[model samples]
Target: MAPSDPVVDPISSRLDYDVGELRRAELAADPVAQLRRWLDDAGRAEVPEPNAMAVATVDADGRPRVRNVLLRNLDEAGLVFYSNRLSAKGQAIDANPVASALFSWLGLQRQARVDADVEVIDGDLADTYWANRPQGSQIASAASPQGEVVADRAELEALVERYERDAEGLDIPRPEHWVGYRLVPHTFEFWQGRRARLHDRFRYRLTGGSWEIDRLAP
Candidate 1:
């Protein structure tokens, strides 16, 4: 085979997406409500981790960074996800308090994008979610430093064991670093895959305290 010939070429293997459509009449006046509807549908369709969203942030150097995080709460306020305040993504959020998140339900051939301002929330809300977590997860969250380098797996296990021993006689309190962030969206785009790459897209943008919906070309 020639050097230019690839061993596994994916350029010609694109799948035609025709799973759904987005119509103006069917859209919710509020984008958040529309998002909730789509989320509920994804759950009913048994899409694994239906609440997972890829959150994108910009580092201090202006490079874009993206990582998947589970959506814990969603309402008119915003979308919430919890993480360590000192993690890489967290630092990025601190440096640049705006973020964009994408939710992809490939099985349904649908995707949603959210661009928003980030705000941290702690106090009772964080505590409530922390309390609902499994004991092992609590220990892990309190033990291992997220996005930090460790000597090895043994070092991490040791930290977990230490936390376990410390919490034997009492509750494992939530760490100060572990907190939730809410993304107050300024714009949202909902995409539905259609035949022949002519996907349907609708964008809801906040303008003058009201949402202005527009159709986007795929």
Candidate 2:
């Protein structure tokens, strides 16, 4: 017998939000600075997991996948996150070097979207970040076999216990399979929601190795 084909959903109703009130006047001169300001505001607003972002990547077949990952670092170079090289996300990134990330701060009614080209960071940078992590996190990294299927919770607990005992009072080394990745942004969009569904939207696109900011239709 053959397997059944998957069902597809039809087009849904259109819902429009006019983004007009969010003007360039509300943004910083520099997009990076604007992003930082939003991040700071999110932190002050007590948003849970302010540093967390939805990372999206495509597979070889062009199917997109997304998952929530902690934003470990961000700068002019772009956003950074760490993961196991052998994990599903790592494999997807290796196959397709392009990715996108989205940051949503519901409390502030703001969201930032980024589309970028990605590359794995150097070992030295990964090591420095690894060293700063709490001992428990380091131990957890060693114990968790990301993207692998385990028998049950007991198997994971056993591995955690073993690593905890083995790493007792010793310097936890960064695992060879774990590393950081940097996403170089080619385009970034900032969205701010306002009353009556009129919002602000500004986009920055890379042009001639420089950023060109423009007001996009809301």
Please name the candidate that would achieve the greatest TM-score relative to the true structure: 1
lDDT, candidate 2, equals 0.86
Off by over 4 Å in 1: 1-8
**Candidate 2's residue-wise lDDT over 1-218, tens digit each?**
99785464345533354433466767776677788888887898899999889999998788999999998888998889999978888889999998999999876778999999999999999999999999989998988999799999999989999999988989999999899999889899999876556677789888998788898766
Q: Candidate 2: where are CA atoms >4 Å away?
A: 1-21
Specify the highest-lDDT model's number: 1
lDDT of each: 0.94, 0.86
TM-score of every prediction relative to native: 0.95, 0.87
- RMSD to truth, every model: 2.0, 5.5
Residue 8, candidate 2: alpha-carbon lDDT:
48
Clash pairs for candidate 1: none
Candidate 2 matches the true fold with a TM-score of: 0.87
Q: Give the TM-score of candidate 1.
A: 0.95
